[model samples]
Target: MQARHFKETYSELLSLTDSVPERVWTGILIAGCLALPWVVGSYSLSFATLSLVMIVGVLGLNLLTGVCGLISLGHAGFMAVGAYGAGIAAADYGLSILPSMLIGGLIAAASSLLVGIPSLRLKGLYLAITTLAFTVISTHVILNTPEITRGSTGLFLPEPNFFGYELNTPQKYYLFCLATCVLFVLATLNIMRSRVGRAFIAIREQDIAAEMMGINLRRYKLLAFAISAFYTGVSGALFAYHIRYINVDTFGLTLSIEALGMIIVGGLGSIAGAIIGAIFMTLLPEAVRMFFELFATQLNGLFATRALELRGLIYGAIIILILRFQPEGLIKIWRECRRIWGNWPFRY
Candidate 1:
């Protein structure tokens, strides 16, 4: 009876959304996203749109590292592959942005299999190093093959269009990214409620234990890698369109490190964490820049230059502070807030 009760509880926890409140709140959030572009200024709209892109990419990383317990350092390489793939397809082959993005995602997924098969077998530092090598190799190939990618000179992307409509304005592009983000988020939510998601969690907790329960370790790990790569690739394609430019330096080790930081700061194994982390990281640099701009006049020129140079230092400091104070991340703070309000009039 106890075992049955525990099983029932576990199953209930596995559902995508269990309460009417959750559904209602989700609806409200989606509605807000739909209405945001009409009210915000062009600059704010663009920032928000880019934030949504980062959310999608970080979500993919969450699935792999957070949920599946796979350490990857080559995600930027996958994004580069997607960005370049879409760029080539749209510029050279005259394909629409949507189809080009899909092609990019598919190509990235296929490429993941090549890396995942051999690398997934390794764990910890070995896996990380292997993926890092992939990044290096990818960068070298793109730089050497200048005829196709335009090499270090960079490649310009055409504006994205949908069914004969061009998304030239910031507002229109916001809507496009907003809609795409919603679709991907909903798809990820459903996946997290499915058997595959459970398999990922089990593997994250203990691969040996998961395999003992008859889960195919290699198969699921590769699937996780492929799926994660697909999401990141799609984001990359959109990024190329968003920035209208692509270069070998654009998707480098630092971007990969930032993606990892987004997941870590958000909270592993939680979708909300991924979203929160994306927003936080996306806005942080802007915040820093604004601070410098506001105070640059107050400081000496050399001091001002040093302040700007402290960009890396500032970012590292913030991450360290967050890890030290809230290792579980901002998601835990969110949960606490909900718990406090959800049980209003009663003290915990």
Candidate 2:
């Protein structure tokens, strides 16, 4: 009787995965998201919130590199635009947080248009170099625009709100961030599985061939940039609100590289890969930090400050190792595991 009951439960759970419609799956995901903060511990909820924000950045970069097949080393500049915009709108303009975020996203998207239009015309290395140049320009602009960004001093942001309630607690903030990230992810999945997604894949596979097939390169390419920039901007706005502070140092070239590292390790061109990348990269540092704290107690001195430098070296080396051994990344390995499990009986 117990064996029968266990089989029944397993079958029921597995059937949910097979029988659920796409729309129903979305609704279920939404329901789960709403329940997450309540069910999970506060610390875990906070970590999930940060992971979701990282997902936003990863999604944007994925669109640019994975979909559009355009590499950008200046994505962090787009993020900076959103971050500072949120800060200024929240503090000086005294705007609502929702509108502040929207404003930041639109402005970031618009700014990318200028960068994308011309940069898209260039091919390969030239295009990457152009984007990198934009990063340099963005740094200079932030440093010089003291009247607006306040230079290196940074600015504080107003508290986020919903229905006149300040989302002051980590739980509240986590809910908002998680909701937005999930929304973005769902929208991205829908878009990627649509006609535009096909065009993106076509272009990625071969731009000239895609153009031959009647896909408009300029329009789609710009669309990719605009879409990507929009997501990054939203994430940046969320970051600003969560931290409630902003400066030039917050967004830089290092962040851009980190984004690349995440997508590469998680799986380039896969949304699942992007999310996996974000979670791993964001949490890994925290884990490393904890190790350093424990190590400091044992090693007694000098190790605490030196630990950060060691962390950087470790991060770089690990990335290199992952690329060398598993260039297809974590996503490919995940898919393989699923495939193997599905065909387990054939193994005999």
lDDT of each: 0.88, 0.83
Model 1 agreement with the true structure over 1-348: per-residue lDDT tens digits: 022233347657766655768889989998998899988888888889999988888888899999999988988999998899999999898888889989988888888987899986799889888888888888898899999999999999887887578988888888889888988888899888789999999999999999999999999999999999999999999899999999988998998989999989989989999999999999998888787777777775855568767776787899899999999998989999987777776736
C-alpha lDDT of candidate 2 relative to the true structure: 0.83
* Most accurate candidate by lDDT: 1
The candidate that achieves the highest TM-score relative to the unseen native structure? 1
| RMSD per model, one decimal | 3.3, 5.9
Candidate 2 TM-score to native: 0.87
Error of 1 at 153 (Å): 1.9
